[model samples]
Target chain A: MDLSPIWLTLKLAAITTSLLFIVGLPIAWWLSKGRSFFKTIVEAIITMPLVLPPSVLGFYLLLAFSPQHGLGKLLQDTFDTQFVFSFKGLVLASFIYSMPFMTGPIKSALQQLPVSLTQASYALGKTQWQTFKSVLVPNIKPSLLTAIVLTFAHTLGEFGVVLMIGGNIPGVTRVASIAVYDSVERMDYAAANTYSLILFSITFVMVISVFVFNKYQAKSPLE
Target chain B: MIDLSIEKRLKAYRGQQILKISHQFTTGSITKIYGPSGAGKTTLLKTIAGLVYPEKGKIVVDSQTWLDTDNNINLPPQKRMPGFVFQDYALFPNMSVLAHLQYATNDMEWIKRLLLLGKLDTLTDHKPIHLSGGQQQRLAVLRALAIKPKLILMDEPFSALDPDMKTELIAELKLLFKELAATVLIVSHNPQELEGLTDGDLYIP
Candidate 1:
């Protein structure tokens, strides 16, 4: 049983989760502010991934990044980057696939905070960025942790998008989910079962930890 | 001295009501504001602090134009830099009694003085959640004072404190306000709370 697929899957999940955390915070913060038609449209687009089938997202990403097409052609000409059927494509696909998981909790947490918290910080002469970092972000720690974990777990379980854009290539795009499917197709029951169990156990542990942590937080006097 | 004239449209239950005010506050004066509910007392404070922008207003603080809708100049809250104590206390649940002051300024001596003034020096490490309502309210007041600001706006700041505690704290705060030469605007539902402390009075109908 080759372990390359498992390592690749872990790497993809780590990279995708890290990038999503950095990108999602600002997006969530902006969205959590006063609502508008433009913000509603952007939020709808970001949230579409949660309800839309992963294969639909994968299909669109493939069309958008195919080297023979407009955007893909421009990228190929300018940056010499090929997204389709590559690790980069897998990472990109996972971003769209797992974005809602990264932004949902954070946005809601931010919205639930008292308006006076920000106002108090501002009245104290703290800049917006300073208040966000020192006050807003610190207060949203639990939700932030939940967002990171859910994004990582969701990325690890990604199968449809990876299949559509990132063709199963050993040591590159052949992540655990793809490997499990390949094993099953080859009638390799033992390998399929092993990979399935590993993925299932890891995700279960992560989800359980989130529940436990949140429960502990609920019981604490300080929020 | 601060000269402020502002008008804001508020969404009252009975159609819309406009809040209009034109007032001057002398430097180092403490003014008590009293009004019925929905009269926009808090909104007035927020507008002055730059938390809320009035539809038409001019706020000139010590010759500095903080807001002038006619001139289209509006300084943000950070630039205005007034100290404010919110009605809800608005203490950071994650920060200790000391961290709140530390976030405002790095003056160790000032911080120590504020801690002692609020009588929260012994509870420096305690978060807002652990403090009693009075303690939390005092901490909010202390956090506002930590900046040693030229202006302080408070909304129902002593509502949570017992009468005796309120009196003692007010007495101490009066001397401190004089020492710092800070002007203050306090919105109170109870007029008696700030009877002797305020030199001026503003009543909103």
Candidate 2:
């Protein structure tokens, strides 16, 4: 069994999750707290990936990453790095696909928190960043955990977008989901079953551990 | 002296009305704000704290203009840093009793003294979930005092305490407020409860 696909999938999930956290936290915070007129439009755009078909999103990404025009042309001319059919391309696609999974929970978590907590922090002379870091983030641990797990798991199982943009290049973009598809197409049921079992077990353990940890935290006096 | 003249349009189920207030509060004095429900008492406190903005207003604190609509200047809450005790006792659930005070100041002696004042010394490590209603209220008061703010605004701060506890805490707080030379505005539906402690009164209709 070539475990390279598993390693690539893990790497993709890891990088995508980290990038999502960096990019998604500010978006989630703004969506949760801001009352601007443009909020609805931005929210609708971010949530598009959740409802749109993966192939639709992938097609647009493919066009955007094409070296002939727009962002792809700029990247090719300046950075000289091709985004399509590469690990970087796969990462970008996975991030788009998994954005809602990361941002939704975080936004709801921030909204559900008592407004008075932030007010209190401000009254105590703490800045907005201080209040967010010391008060809001600590209290919303459960939601943060849920967002991370869901984004990681969702990215791990992604297929259509990865298939369209990644093109199944082994050792570079051949993630576990693509590997399983390849095995089945070749009538290699044993290899497909092996990949499927490994994916299922890993996801199940991750989800179960999160639940167990949450329950334990709930039982603790501090929570 | 703290001077404020403000107008805010408030919409309630009854109708829309203008909350127009103009007043001067002396430094180091305790003033009671008495009003019926929905008369904008809490809103007034929030406005002074810079948590809410008024349609038209000027708030001058100690010769400093905190808010000046004509000048288009409105300081943020952090810049104002007024100590406020909410009616609901907005203690952070994730933070322990001691952590709440420590977050506002680095003075260990002040923190210890505040814990003693609030009678929360023994429960320093306890979170808000573990504390009783009165204990939580006391913690809120202590947290507000942690900054030794020049102005303190309290909304129904003693509603959760028993009569005896309220009396005792108010006595201690009166001395502490004087020591800090902090102007205090306390909102209450029952003004008699604060008769002796309040030096002046403002009625909102």
Candidate 3:
């Protein structure tokens, strides 16, 4: 088991989760608060990555981020950087692939909430942004935690999208899951087994952590 | 002072027709809304809090326009400053008693007041879910009060409590509101039930 691949997986997960949180928060907020004809369409599109075949997502993502497409060419021409076969490309792919995992819990939790939580803050003469940052975020703690863990874990185990966009460029886009596949193909079962076990352990820990936190919340003093 | 003349069509799925009701709350006094199960009590309270938008009308609280459907203006809940406690509404699951109060303003003195008000001094460190139902109801009051809004809206705040706890809460509220001169609006099935808490004015529908 090469340590580089392991580190790369962790890095990918971190970058993807951080990026998603920045954009996903507003999107989830809108879904919970607003009603529009396009709202359902937007939600379905966001969740498409979850249900879509990983390979199909990878294929479209590869084309979308490549220099051939408008977005990809714009990024390259403007920033003097290419996304394909790069760490950035891997992050972008992981972000799209695991978006639903990040947004689903957050949206549901926000919806389940009463406007009272945020209202309470505003009534105290606080600004809306301040209220969201302080009151809403802290109140929806478990949902945000769940979103982070699921997105990170999902990004860590990602294969298809990374395979298409990242192209297995060692030391750059060669994540642990891909390395595991490469190892098995090369008849290195021990290395593959090690990588597999690590991924499993990481995911197992996240699931267990969620359960423990929920149980703990159920016993909170402010019930 | 809060004044709302809002008309909202509430779509109820439970065999009740769409409801269109318009009401107003005047300034500087406790207003109790008494109605049967299907009456517009909760809707009225929530509208004043900006949680629900009325179909038509104007809402002016303390000279600020909150909602004017004719003028096409509706402020979201985050823009309104009203302490609200819906029936059985609990504090956030992720926060402890102290953390929940932190939203009101990280002011330690006010937190202490709330802790003492609800007899929650020892439970300040505990999470909301860990408390008993009675404790939760008490915390709800303290949480709403901690915000120090000009007005407070409670939807059947005492409905679920045992008689002893309800009377104790009402007695406690009388002292608190009279001392602060706060405007507390309550919605209940039995408008006359909470005599100890009110100033002896009940508006029944």
Best candidate per DockQ, number?
1
- lDDT per residue (tens digit) for residues B101-190 in model 2: 989999999999999998999999999999999999999999999999999999999999999999999999999999999999999988
Residue A152, model 1, lDDT: 95
Quote model 3's TM-score for chain B. Answer: 0.88
Q: Give the least accurate 10-residue stretch of model 1 chain B, judged by summed lDDT.
A: B76-85
State the local distance difference test value for candidate 1. Answer: 0.92
Candidate 3 at B24: error in angstroms?
A: 5.8
After superposition, the stretches of candidate 1 with alpha carbons farther than 4 Å from their true spots are A219-223
**What is candidate 2's lDDT per residue for A21-91, written digit by digit as tens?**
99998889989996777998888888999999998999999999998999999999999998899999999
DockQ category of candidate 3: acceptable
lDDT of 2 at A174: 94
Q: For residue B174, what is the lDDT in candidate 3?
A: 75
The deviation in Å at residue B71 for candidate 2 is 1.7
* Local accuracy of candidate 3 as per-residue lDDT tens digits, B48-79: 77777676778887788888988888877667
Question: Per-candidate DockQ versus the true complex?
Answer: 0.90, 0.87, 0.42
Model 3, residue pairs in steric clash: A123-B81, A219-B130, A220-B127, A220-B130, A221-B127, A222-B127, A222-B128, A223-B128, A223-B129
> Candidate 3 residues A1-223, lDDT tens each?
4689999999889988999999898788878876888999999999999889888988887788789768889988999888898998888888888899888888887887776666555555678678677667777777888888888888988998899988888899899999999999999999999988988998898878877776756533112
Chain A TM-score for each candidate, in the given order?
Answer: 0.95, 0.95, 0.89
